[model samples]
Target: MAGRLRCPNCAAPLRLAGRVLRCAGGHAFDVARQGYVALAPPRRRLAPGDSPEMVAARETFLAGGHYRAIAEAITEATPAELIPSAGGAPLALDLGAGTGYYLAALLDDRSGWQGIALDASRPALRRAVRAHPQIAAVACDVWQELPVQDACADLLLNAFAPRNGPEIARVLAPSGALVVVTPTQSHLREIVDALGLLDVDADKQGRLHAALAPRLQSERRRELEFTMTLDHEQLRALIAMGPSAHHLQPRQVAERLARLPQRMRVGASLLIETFRRSGAAGASA
Candidate 1:
């Protein structure tokens, strides 16, 4: 994984030596004991990704298999056949890969696939590194220039996270595919209404298409819709695991949860879409 990384400062190839990764130009980053690296630039103005509490909640909820259907859809939708065989092991870059749950499942389905789980949060990367032995986790801001070299990744994954269109285009191999999972307007509507959480923007899809224009062309799109009957604990974890956690206080969340039914049918709806580098002939399955 270190071999695949470049120095964010100099864009020089990095080599792992003991606990440090150093480039020929003398730039260095220390690898954490838990086996993840930080490549984000020293100064950042934006708030950090997910906090420890959020990551913990997410880990717990995902471990219970609440989102198994969505994870399965992503794994099945990935076009592993399109990846070039020239690379020793095809690399799958999981951008904003919190906890690496989806990437871990994909690696399990695709033999010989290696993963790089990139996130802006150290807490998320800590868990991501342990998700699979084949995964190498990196803590870096996706909004900035990625630490990855050009045209190296066979598959780039962005699931319910911010997208960096140009960075994604630059890192993906010509024949590679990009998989994104976004929530539709009706997704988790019941939960949102019940707790007064943030709403999914009505024009999110249109905005996404505009953002990717002329750089990535759509290859496939699938809508996964399901219902989960969640108990109080499940519901609480679900809320704590998402953006709502940032807005609502613990007392407010508890009050809302207490008013809701003990068991409720929650809608889980998401769009799993795939794209290819613009102007590249669609790879045959």
Candidate 2:
């Protein structure tokens, strides 16, 4: 609610008056009590991307700083020029942003930066906006056109989300960077094996590269490793943040949890890749 929200139709800056957001051309949208909107029309609704329980679990785990390294890397890589408003006032976008933890962490590292946190879950955005004043939480599907304008974002962060690379490339200006963080094979392997769910595939990076080749060029790639030991409550929270948690039955999950040690050593791996967008990408959602 700082700068006028950009009009989804024409990328014009919107005017906020009372509970309504209106573009210069007179297209109007409503603001919810949680301070976000549904820009996607009926035709665009897909499966709900995240559940309330998942979002809550993620928020709990992230608040404990379990993913601190990734947040630090993101802060370090933010280009100075892209941070338009100086004194740490950057305009960043966190796509499929769950609980706004990474964005909140980056803002903490570099003060005064503002961000737009987008997710399909209203519950997640509700929790996110409360965490930081700088963030403008928006509930929207990632597959649809993002609500912001072209070349307006300093950094685009997608952590474990469905990516539309061409669309991401369109929104980034020259020298603007996109950071995609995906889990590696060893990450959550023990849980996956125990739950009888799909394992992290070997060709995930290759598939990402192939999918993103049209609009992005990789600038740097780094592998991060960390170990987190969780008590039962933390273990339950961590498990609920993943896809397996959604797919498994409650009793089955409880049974498996009972079998685990009082404290479990969980090793995790992440690939942090920074990319620059190629030209020829257009704003088509």
Candidate 3:
């Protein structure tokens, strides 16, 4: 876990000792029995991320393979996966790696690489730690400085989560690449009206570019759209696993879901993109 991670307090390299990760400056964090280390600064008490229910819902929904295509696209767009024989075994970092589903895919194609799954949610990291044997899970706020070393990660991944552009560019290896997955408004179109879901940001793509700026260069972008026929329980899990779960009451969820058919078809759309450090040779537009 300390392979590419730095101490949250001192930003020094961390070394594992017994059940704790410690920096040369004496800052120490105990690794939980659940196999994840929480790296958030203790004083700030950053707000909790995905709740237990949300994590469970996501685990269930993803295990259903509804978004398998999206995961595959993320892995395919990653440049590092193709060069598994790179000098040192490459490292892949997943920002807001939820349950490690996408990271798992990337690792599947790259035999020798290891993955670091970063998420604010302990519940998500817990699942991530268990999702794959080669994955190391860390709990850290995405908006805060990531507890990772500079220019260490060979690949970075972001899926349906926040992106910290500067932190991302700083952590990526000079020759590394980044893959991001964001949903288009067309995603779950049928459920949007029925479930009172939040509207997908209209300027999401424009804002993404602005945030990364000259620090990162865009390489490729593609939209993969698909359909799913979800049953009653599947529909409920789909809504519960998203941001809507925070605002929707149980009664409201039940009431809205009650009106929808037992099984309904919905479109799934994701904008997948790949980027490289701006100064990298042949960095794309």
Candidate 4:
């Protein structure tokens, strides 16, 4: 809803007037025809986060529900009592919310909740807007100061996205929780070497928690692992949708995928951690 969005220029609450969102400070952001809006700082240019091709590949891959367990695990961890609400309506913020797949799943039965998909990519927002009726797509870099009302979000979800610990701590309400989903070392191990895909870092999660120690405390953790049967086509989408796509050429990727069997069992492993503000919450995040 417009009530949560603040102007990146003046930090004022945005009001929806017709198809435009304007703040009292006279800063206006136009809603795109695709049903989303850009809220990046007006003075700074955003480096296109994901290309249209990459976004398309990710959309196709997620639509197949290859990672449905990740979404389900997040929903299972957050009970009704754990989620905060604003005026009886829950608010969910998904960082690096590519296509808003996980957020859509979380809000499936919660009709009273609104989900905001924040990403730096315009291409991703195009599909994110249609992920759910209550989803509001905004284009903004997650590493910078989020353009949302302070302490307004009831829940924040970060799945395979960048984390801005300070900014995250600043935006979360006192009782709100932050759920982060990351891949374990075993994830994609079957095909990582064969396809030269990006390798998972086992200790990455450790560093993440340490970085947020000043403001957040991990409350719960879960490991969700499964094997998915993916054909060459599905495998290609998985490859093209992530960081490896940037390092590999189109021909190289196609050639590598061709070497795979008709169907390959790919391991899907993830570590989900739920965190809430710590005793140092008042410290400058």
Candidate 5:
């Protein structure tokens, strides 16, 4: 854990001193030996976020370029029209940002875009801040009100994380764009079947629209599909990026993985949907 942890309770700047992150306001949070802090309130303990291992897996899997297409899609869908007149860099939020890979990709060439990388997992936040200096890694959950001020974000990017449409709406600047990237139904289909995981349903898009219809207007949607070849080590990395890594027994995964081809052709699919936050007349009650 970094010494300079911000106090979640009092919004005070904190510094690491031995075992705890302490603020002048006297709020102290213990740093777990495994390198994460519990920032959630008691009632929010059950909120589902990535575990430390899951974060590691995502970091490794994304580092391999298997997900480059998603990154490219994000760049292509950026709201270029909103960049000017803002007078400063665009404010982008990577909700559930893991290791800051995607956010870092978006921040690469463009100057002046301040990124807030929010995640419940402190390890992920730590990795994010270290990986991307431009990002301010905040430890928080997405389901609750975002810690940011209302109408401040120029764009919100939710990739492979749960969505809170109303919460997202409140945080977006009027005309702010909401870009969501989700796996398509057939995404990693071969691997899902081979590994005995549940398949993404055909109704995923319909449900997405149903959830956001009243509060958002979909501007555009694009689907990307590609194939990548992975060795055994890469296969292990990919498995780690999923829930089965935590849910399934190690023996089961190992046994299944052992039977896979040394370098297999894996299909990947993703949908990039951009929406404008409905405000005033378009606001959801």
Candidate 6:
């Protein structure tokens, strides 16, 4: 499947040779020893996505099975049999995939499916590479053109990450589907109110539709809501795993967390929307 990748520099097809990927245009990217590749263009102005501390917190929190319901919802929404694998096994690209928790679970049930976990954080990519044997990690900024060939992805997963609508449309095959998981307003409301965490945007769904309009059409939308019992430590990790960690200082967070109850009921509410290429038959669901 690496043959379907394009060089970030020149958009030429990349060939994997040993530990390096080289394009006919002479641009080369080296695969890390941990089995991931960094495909961001050189010298581009890019902000770091997630810090090591944030990545570690996410890895810990996800390992505890706190969000297994969300993962299951995504897996159920993506039907493996719908994808055709005659050319090769279907390739599932997880854009802004953090720890690859959801993608790993999705791939586990699909026998021949392969996964690519793309994120801007090196720390996150390190853990993503080890998520599963069939998974490959790539460090790239999702806002820019993805380092993937046109119409090469069978499934695209975006969970709590930036939405690069045009790039997504370019990478999805004709029969491909994109599964987006965004937090609803009530998601973690308790923590947001108590800790002053970032709130979900009021017009997120409208904005999402606008961003994806004219290229991809919504197929289905499902809401998954649940409650989690979290201790102080778990709560802290949860806070650190999201954008809230960037806004609040460590001291402020610690003081706030200390005042909370030993155990708290945290809300987990999200909207999982599936989209198909525009003009496809039975586009709406």
lDDT of 5: 0.74
Q: State how far residue 200 of model 3 sits from its true place (Å).
A: 0.1
List per-prediction Cα lDDT, in the order shown: 0.89, 0.75, 0.87, 0.87, 0.74, 0.89
Poorly placed runs, candidate 2 (over 4 Å): 1-5, 9-13, 80-89, 279-285
Q: Highest lDDT among the candidates is held by which one?
A: 6
Tens digit of per-residue lDDT, candidate 2, span 1-285: 424246666667777788887778887778888877755544556449678888888888888877777788777665554545223356778888888888887777666667888888888888778777788887777787777666667678888887876668767655567888999999867666765655777998998898788778777788888888877788777778887776777687788888888887787788888777655232122
Report the Cα lDDT for candidate 6.
0.89
Candidate structures ordered by TM-score, highest first:
6, 1, 3, 4, 2, 5
User: What lDDT is reached at residue 61 by model 4?
Assistant: 94
182, model 3: CA deviation in Å? 0.5
Provide the lDDT at 182 for model 1. 97
Better of 2 and 6 by TM-score: 6
TM-score to true structure, per model: 0.96, 0.88, 0.96, 0.95, 0.82, 0.97
lDDT of 3 at 139: 88
lDDT of 5 by residue, 1-285 (tens): 232234556655667788776778887767565444555443555355677887888888888888988988997887776642145667888878878888888877457777878788776877887776677766677786665556667778888887777777776777678889988878888888888865777887888787777778787789889999888788777877776676677678889888888888889899998888655322233
lDDT (0-100) at residue 256 of candidate 5?
89
Tens digit of per-residue lDDT, candidate 1, span 1-285: 777889988899999999999999998899999889988666654339999999999999999998999889998888857655336789999999999999999999988789999998889989998999899998888988999988888899999999888899889988888999999989889989989999998888888788787788888999999999999899889999898898999899999999999999999989999988777768323
